[model samples]
Target: MSTLGGAGTPNPNKSFEVVQPPTDSISSLCFSPKGNYLVASSWDNQVRCWEVQKNGQNVGSVPKAVMSHDKPVLCSAWKDDGATVFSGGCDNIVKMWPLASGGQLVNVGAHDAPVKEVAWIPEINLLVSGSWDKTLRYWDLRQQTPVHTQQLPDRCYTLTVKHPLMVVGTADRNLIVFNLQNPQTEFKRISSPLKYQTRCVAAFPDQQGFLVGSIEGRVGVHHLDEAQSSKNFTFKCHREGNDIYSVNSLNFHPVHHTFVTAGSDGAFNFWDKDSKQRLKAMARCNQPIPCSAFNSDGSIYAYAACYDWHKGAENHNPQTAKNFIFLHLPQEAEVKGKPRLNTGRK
Candidate 1:
């Protein structure tokens, strides 16, 4: 097996728990808003929640609970109340889970194609989903139909919410911003900071801008405010030797303006935006790090270490690839960047 610190060998210097789950590959992972639980979606068509409350917990050790979809699960999010979970998959449907009621799967929404991203807008208690169908649908849990649907220029792949505004990245390198409070005006479309297709997007803690990742191993710091947008910039990440790897996920620390990124390079790195410096770089897996999430309290970070094998079926290696979830208690020495006011969520 690959052993990086290059192969990611188990060592004492390490500060994280490595978990092996009996699954294929992980597509997405998110932390519970209320507790130490983590919800993950996998290419195995399953969604599982693992508790990371420092009780010797790891991936396969009884995930608190597991749920399945008809096709590979792609994206997931938790409501602000932390009682309900939202999940979307290749089946083109988004399902709502009532965690307080024994994990009942309730079909809440659907799309014309595979749903690429979903997020909870707390101000309105709305669930918004974007699909390859080139549309964004807004849904209210009390109703079965969407409250409104907006068309996009191309397939929507990445999405982020920031209360007053939201951003959606679509095919053709398009980044569209919608004013949450003033929907009557035309949506604002901006040139994507990256040239490749968007892989992930996260709203900045300050709401002055956001982070956007691409399949081309690059990330762009974008500012929504006119004067600040000109100051935006991009950087490269997830490259090993000469291979270009996809940046699968990006998340900003709840309190720290700094952020973390996971990539197909089989690693994740922490960064400080203001200083433009890397806080930490971890080479801890043999497969891609598809997703990573921070807990509500920001005391812990959970990540999925697995082979997305997203290149194609021909590139998959079942014997060599193992599925896992890792939880790390980041020390101040490892990730404490300059602290800033914590924004609620995206």
Candidate 2:
């Protein structure tokens, strides 16, 4: 594993580029809850997995398996057992790959339009998918048809699930929340705190609330309880003077609970929502980071740097655009929350 061009000097927090990256832009990156197995879905119409091997201070990766879809894959999720991965794509279909068996993907779900996001609900053993067709479908892997469907206010752009809590960010600045205990009816529907289109949404580790990022380079923290509405707030990030960039992804540290936001500006930062402070900000890469994920223990951080097509296809340069996934060893201080200062007449 070799560190790439970014910081001019050597630093532990700096990223080491992962080998055998996707040929096209990366749409999503997910780490298995059980281990360091990373599964990535890409616009190349393929889903690939890699096993991150860490030896003392040195780190490396081994390619695991690959699966293909009829169209670009937009999102992927791992089964609770870590033996299987579910991926949805622009082909309007979702496929399940049993990695342990090295078996071919089996079509398990479908949408009227391109599926934008897919997530596995371990609590109920159901697969939920959000699509541009403006519906959320829950699938039971045994059947090809969805077991249940819920309509959305608009096209679904992003979806996240944590047991008993699910949040869907849709077009027209719509934010839909679901209490997975019911898993059918909508728990709440509200407008996005940000004025721009939602780029990503991630649940807090504790499942109390979620963080939503918008195309305008801003993130909003909203609590589920209306009594705590006063605590709901928003912050601006990934901005350089007059240039603002879309926040492409938001992932929480599994242990520390602090979250990181990757953006189109090629920068990512760790933030403590409770302390309302940024824990650390890393150096910006030369290209945008479309997606990122944190390993189960919160020791390893992975991010993909490439053109996200935010500027449209006309601006994409096949020769100049580079796609690489970087594995970073996050230091404790860089991710841990700041201690609350003691203020008293001692």
Choose the strongest candidate by lDDT.
2
Candidate 1 weakest ten by summed lDDT: 4-13
The deviation in Å at residue 192 for candidate 2 is: 0.9
lDDT of 1 by residue, 196-229 (tens): 8888888777667789999999999988778876
After superposition, the stretches of candidate 1 with alpha carbons farther than 4 Å from their true spots are 1-22, 55-62, 183-186, 338-346
Q: What are the models' TM-scores? A: 0.89, 0.95
Error of 1 at 277 (Å): 1.3
Backbone clash pairs for candidate 2 read: none
Worst 10-residue lDDT window, candidate 2? 1-10
Tens-place lDDT per residue, model 2, 54-124, is 77667798998888998999999899898999999899998899998988779997899999999999889
Give the winner by TM-score.
2
| lDDT at 335, model 1 | 68
